[model samples]
Target chain A: MSANVKQKRTLLEWVRGYTGQKYITTVLFLLIPIVLLTLFTLIPAVNMVIFSFQERDQLGVNPKWIGLDNYVTLFTDPTYLSTFKNCIYYFFGSFIQLALALLIATILCSKIKFGNLFKGILFFPYMMNGVAVSLIFRRFFQKGDGITNSEGTLNTILALFGLDPVKWLSTPGLVNVCLVFASIWRYIGFDIIMFIGAIQSISPDVYEAADLDGANGWQRFWYIVFPSIRSIVALQLVLAIKGAASVFEIPYIITGGRNDTSTFVIKTIDTAFVYKKVGLGSAMAIVLLLIILIITGIQKLCFRERK
Target chain B: MAENKHYFDLKDYTFKETPKSVRILFQVLKYAFLVVCCLVVIIPLIIVLFGSLKTHDEYIQSNVFALPAVPQFSNYVTAFNQGNVLRGLFNTMIILVISCFGTIITGTMTAFVVQRFNMMFTKVVKAIFLIVALLPSISMQVTVFQIVNKLGLYDNMAAPIIMYIGTDIIAIQIFIQFLDNISVSLDESAILDGCSYPRVYWSIILPMLRPAIATVLVIKFVGIYNDFYTAQLYMPSPKNAVVSTALYTFVGPYGAKWEIIFAGIIICIIPTLVIFLALQKSIYSNLVSGSVKE
Candidate 1:
């Protein structure tokens, strides 16, 4: 072979040593996923941050790069302001939902038979299509039809005890109340599973020692179990809140953004596609992203301190 | 005799004939609680079944929990009448099949690179993984919507297929944990033997990744099967809808046809249920096995 041929072969051989075919394979596998993430996730995120400050004209294509004009509009807009207020209202459910799930998980974990079976059953709702569940609720919540007339599950059971029916779906604030129920139904199992796994990771020996010292059931729980799984609790709380705030499918499909259920997510979609104000919608999403980031950063700090 | 009887005091006694009735009472309570909990889980499913039998007018007259006065199975036929259920099913299957394979392959490769390779920019790569994990799904939604819309893939299944593979950090994270259990000595031996890293991975490491592979496959399959959000956002056109979306269309914005909605819901549930039942053991045990460890 010529010297040039030898040199090329040697270079190929060296590349082979450093990375082998794995490097090329690695690059190939990472290519599509990375490109998609960069274009869709990273670039869009940057555009959103930029768009939130800009104003768009009638055509809705070009952003006129106004100085926080969109943000100014956001504060003045009733739909925007009300939904933002409702966002805080929505946050209350997250706390209760997580707490409720955590409580059930705790009870079930404390020597319940077929804990795995129970956990599986509880998580069944999570597997459901959110839209499907929402439809079920819509009928169940129909004014004077399901709840008041005892046609829905809750009202039927209540009526059996000789109580009046409730117009569950038609009630103003009850929409959120039903959302909590739906959320709690779907997520309680997940919270329990996560907590159970974390709680189970605590050695039985610690509980046994506490028992030997005559620590009561509640005492053992507080002193021994609580401190042990603090980190896991922090993780669960953060994830649960994150899940709740991002909720769109249930409200969108079930209620169709009616009855005060138009959350940040619902309105964001509307502002973009429905209202044809893509720039404004993108700006709103950017604000949401910032809120999520701040919350996550706080959670990390909390978790770190917990450790 | 009295002293001897006192020795057999209450502290040392098992359930006696005197407490036998109480024992039975407690046993009944146990079963009752168990049944109630199970009822809570299955009630929604039962309602869906009974609701589907109601005629559109009956659905309006009766509450959701009311028994169907007439058991009409034609709601299912009605559900089919709205659109081509079979076509949507086919489209969903195609998207699922492609994405399932893509997720498995790409997920495995990413995990392998992050765990096995010690590149100069390992820190940067690892940081990216954390960012993906820590970020909320909605945080990424805006960007995805704008770009996918701009690229003119809004009505296509390709968007979700790509998203599944791209955002699948959990499977990779799980695989990394599994890989940690594997001794690195085998890879070292392969290197000494002049086997390339790709060759080593494919021939040696990939075989060991079977358990992780099974976990990722089963979990992702279930996720895509029941997925509504991505399908709704990206594939809004009716013809391209998945089962989840097809069911939603039946219950359109104006008024829901309960019978058809129920039929669609039941139809959607059966596939996932059968798959889950067959692999319940693996799914249950996979979650239990060394996840979230320090």
Candidate 2:
């Protein structure tokens, strides 16, 4: 009995030693990511919050604390707040993109020939550099100089259809629509890929049962597919909302945020870099961050209650 | 049923017993939608290809879709030289290589440690990553810019490289999920054989992580390569131009020569398109697994 007890004690000691060694390895391995994360993400995030409350006079100089002044300007300034209205165009565009992506993804996940080829072609845009896409679409929507008699790709197609050419990028009201349209084209591929993945993950047995039960196509989709992929849809909804609010590249590259097509992010970047209003730009960024956080929080609560 | 075990194949039977007319109509509509989407995607790309070969006179005289009378291969050469695309490609390659290596190492290590060890510290690290991911990284760029400047990393390639390595939440998630799939007994067996935990990780864990690494590497490469904002903001110098920024050089306030810009766009697109086509299968599945596993 004593011998057995002694062996047990030794085994217990060995297990303790194993755990101690494991903990040491964990700390050692975690060192680099922790250090880098702190230096880059944590420190910068804290400094951003501080910068939002301070005023900077010059580049490379220290900023002075000006409590609530930057926040006050952001709320009161018409020029600053007006850019957020542009997000509405993109917000609505994102929903349209989501719906189309869902439809296409669902179809692709079904009995379609050339499904792989179609997916490849559709997803190719997401792989292309954003700047390249912006440039391509810029030419796509070019307004013809009547003197030169040259028309943009879209207008030429319109002319072919016996419809008069429309000023795609020049008209103030229509320009955001064009910009949002481009945004959808670039991003809808991502949504399709994501939705297709979600749709495909549904087990075939489930579908087989639905088929045996004489479930029609629409019935199967509405009852089974919709519920199955609802989580991804919810997650993507939040992502789409954030993306719309913070849209920067398409409009920034195509229009350079000119002609009232500036989104919140472009305006913030310009305010900080172009206009040298660092404090105000930081405040704008913080506001945008808060808005995103609130949206995410609401989504979580809504999802939880539904579940 | 044996041959058609894939989910898509299983879906075909559901349509089989339906009335033939409705089935045919649905099939046609599906093809129609797909074909239209494909055309919409391909047309803009085709126009760029056509425009790149056209002469200045031809571009101005013809509509956007008209094919070039003669292919001007020299336009690519001109864009190559004038747009500084070669230099940009070189710089982007440098950033891609270092950042990919760093992200894989740091991401895998964090995943291995956190998932294998059940501890309060591990929980905290996981929570930290989740919170950071939720916080919009773009909105905080203003302060990151200041930090980069203060650290004297402005206009330095290391600036973007470090940021890319550090800010990879998706990579960590991918790694963690992969580690979870790996049996813990493998590590324990190695440990039982008098191997240290680090040894177990190196010999057993790292080898098993090949698929995950490939997924992470491909995803990281594409993301870092296509990134224009970080490359533009941090390293704005002509000498420091990456592929995306190099293309931006052609943009002017007045009308740019469209042919050359089109050439530049083509040059930037070919590398990614080739990669995508070659790894199309794995890329799709890996992206799906990584994302949905989250």
Highest DockQ model number: 2
lDDT tens readout by residue for model 1, A1-307:
6999999998898777655465676686567667766776677667777666666532446667778777878778877757755555556777876676656566555544575676677766665656667776665555444322336666766777999878776688877778666656665655666666666667766766865786655566678777887777776667656666677766777677788877888888787767767667777887777777788989878767855
Instruction: Score each candidate by Cα lDDT.
Output: 0.69, 0.85
- TM-score, candidate 1, is 0.87
Off by over 4 Å in 1: A1-3, A19-26, A57-60, A110-117, A144-150, B1-37, B55-70, B81-83, B253-256, B285-294
The two-chain DockQ for each candidate, comma-separated, is 0.30, 0.55
Q: Report the poorest 10 consecutive residues by lDDT, candidate 2 chain A.
A: A55-64
Query: Which candidate tops lDDT?
Result: 2
Question: Per-residue alpha-carbon lDDT of model 1 for B18-60, expressed as tens digits?
Answer: 4676655654554566567668778877888887788877876
After superposition, the stretches of candidate 2 with alpha carbons farther than 4 Å from their true spots are A1-20, A57-62, A146-149, B2-23, B253-255
Tens-digit lDDT string for candidate 2 (B122-159): 98998898788766776677778877888899999899
The count of residue-pair clashes in candidate 2 stands at 0
